[model samples]
Target: MTPEEWQAVLLSLRVAFFATLVSLPFGILVAMALARWRFPGRQILNGLVHLPLILPPVVTGYLLLLTFGRRGTVGQWLAELGIIFAFNWTGAVLAAAVMAFPLLVRAIRLSLEAVDPGLEAAAGTLGASPIWVFATVTLPMILPGIIAGAVLAFAKAMGEFGATITFVANIPGQTQTLPSAIYALLQVPGGEERAMRLVVIAIAVAMSALLLSEWVSRAIARRIAS
Candidate 1:
């Protein structure tokens, strides 16, 4: 692959990594809330969490642009603090995170839901504080789910295109990720070979992540069972 292709590959990895890393804590909290907490507007929160999945990618992208663009309500305010998102690689990261968040939350939520409340109640009975109970018992049981959710979110970020492009404009070396690069190559004549190369790389990265997630989850489950 050429230098530009290499850049795209690296940028995609970087963007996806940061997007997943940054979203992990929030995803965990949101998942915990959805799975364990009974609160008003729970359904509304759930719907909003999964909204991106139901909406068109382009539409999601457009919404990001509207909300985070340079002149946008939030964007302008953020820009005052020197935190810009519109037309930047960081914007790509934000876009990818938003697009991938639902999968991350869903995976973790299911994992949390599957946990036995009895175990937690027992810990509480034994005088463990709520936070301690969660840290010791709940977190261990839900480790596999967190791993799976993170991998899913990473894979989703790797392939993110519409929101990224709309928000970041696919500038090379700055915002051109793997999917955006492939799309760009496909639009030109004689670019199929390069596009195919990227396609393979994307598939390889995604598959590797999934396999690694499976292995880690199983290993953790076995350890927990033992």
Candidate 2:
């Protein structure tokens, strides 16, 4: 791969890493809420969390632009604080995180739903606070699911293009990720080879993440079982 291609790969890895990392905590919280709690506006929250998945990527990007652009409502406020997302790599991270959030939440929520409530109640009866019970008893049992969800979120972030490009404008070496780079390359003649190479790289990276997630999750499960 060319140097530019390599840059895109590296930038993509960086963006996906941060995207998954930043979103994981929120995903877990949201998942736990959706799975374990009954509250007002629960369905609304769930729908909002999954809206990116349901809406067109372009629309999602446009909304991000309106909300986080330098002159945007939230963006203008953030810009005053010297934190900008418009046309920057950080914007790519935000875009990827938002786009991949639903998958992460879904995976973790399923796992949470599958967990036995009695285990948590037992811990509570033993004088454990809700937070303590979750941290000590519930969290460990959901380790594999968390791993799976994070990996899936990372993969989704790696492949995000439409929202990313629309929000960040595909600035090479700054915001051009693997998917955007591939898309850019396809726009011109004699670019197919490079595009194909990037495509292969994307597929390889995604597959590696999945396999690693599976291996790690199985290892933890076996250890827990034993």
Candidate 3:
């Protein structure tokens, strides 16, 4: 790959990595809450979490721009705190994270719902604290779901284009990720070859993520069975 292509790949990786890392904890927490708790507005919260998946990407991006744009309400406050997201790498990360969040939440929530409450009760009977029981028993049982969620998020981030470009505007070498780079290349007269290369890279990245998720899920299943 050319320097520019390599740079895009690396930037894409960096953005996806950080986005997934930052959102994983929150995703898990939300999934657990939705699966195991009963609270007011729980249904509303669930719908909101899945909104990006149903809404048009352009609409999601526009909403982000409105809420987090430079002159936007939250953006202005964040800017004063020395954090800027508009049209930057951070914005790209935010867009990716938002778009990928639903998938992560769904995967985790499914696993959480499937967990045997009896196991937790057993741990409690053994005098294990709630937190300790969760850490030692619940987490291990749900490891497959976590891995699946992460992989799904990573794949979604890799293919993210609409929301990202709408929010970040495709600035090369900074906020430009693989999908955006491919879009930009396709727009140029002689950019087909480069765009094709990036497309291949995108496919490879997505396939690898899916394969890894499947492998991890199977491993976790086997471990649990044993």
Candidate 4:
């Protein structure tokens, strides 16, 4: 691979890492809410969380552009604050996060639901506050699920293309993630070799992440069962 290809690979890793890291807390919270809390508008919140999974990637990207573009309602206000996203690497992260969030939330929620409510209640009975109970009791038990969810989100971010390109425009060395780079390469004459190289790398990364997540999830399950 050439220097450009290496740059794309590195940038994709960077973007995916950040996207997963930044969204992990929110994913965990939302998973907890969906798994345990019963509140008004719960169904609506669940729908919104999973909206990206249901919507076309292009539409999601376009919506991000409209909402984060300089002239956009939220974008205009954010611009005054010196934060920008549209057409930048930051926008790629935003797009990737949005697209990956549903998967992250879903994985975490599944794990949370599988947790025994009795354990949490026991912790509470021992006088642990809700926060402490979650941190010391709930969180430890759910670590594997969190890891699995984060890996899934990271893998999703790595392959994110449609929303990323629409939001960030695939600027080389910046927003030019692996998928974007492959797409850009494919458009040119004799770009197949480079594109194929990237394709292989992307598939490898995604597969590795998935395998790792599965292994970790199973290992944790076995440990808890024992």
Candidate number of the best TM-score: 2
C-alpha lDDT score of every prediction, in listed order: 0.94, 0.95, 0.92, 0.92
Model 3 residue 27 lDDT score: 98
Ranking of candidates on lDDT, top first? 2, 1, 4, 3
Cα error, residue 118 of model 2, in Å, equals: 0.7
| lDDT (10s digit) by residue, model 4, range 1-226 | 8999999999999999999999999999999999999999999999999999989999999999999999889999999999999878888889999999999999889889888999989999999999999999989888988998899899999999888988889889888999989999999999999899999999999999989888988888899799
Best by lDDT: 2
Model 3 ranges with Cα > 4 A deviation: none
lDDT of 2: 0.95
lDDT of 3 by residue, 18-113 (tens): 889989999999998899999999999999999999999999998999999999899999999999999999999999999999999999999999
> Per-residue lDDT for 137-159 in model 2, tens only?
99998888899999999999999
Poorest stretch of ten by lDDT in candidate 4: 85-94
Give Cα distance to truth, residue 39, candidate 3, Å.
0.5
Candidate 4 residue 100 Cα shift, in angstroms, is 0.4
What's the CA error at residue 52 for candidate 2, in Å? Answer: 0.6
Q: What is candidate 4's TM-score against the reference?
A: 0.95
TM-scores vs. true structure, each candidate = 0.98, 0.98, 0.97, 0.95
Q: Which stretches of candidate 2 lie over 4 Å from their true place?
A: none
Better of 1 and 2 by TM-score: 2
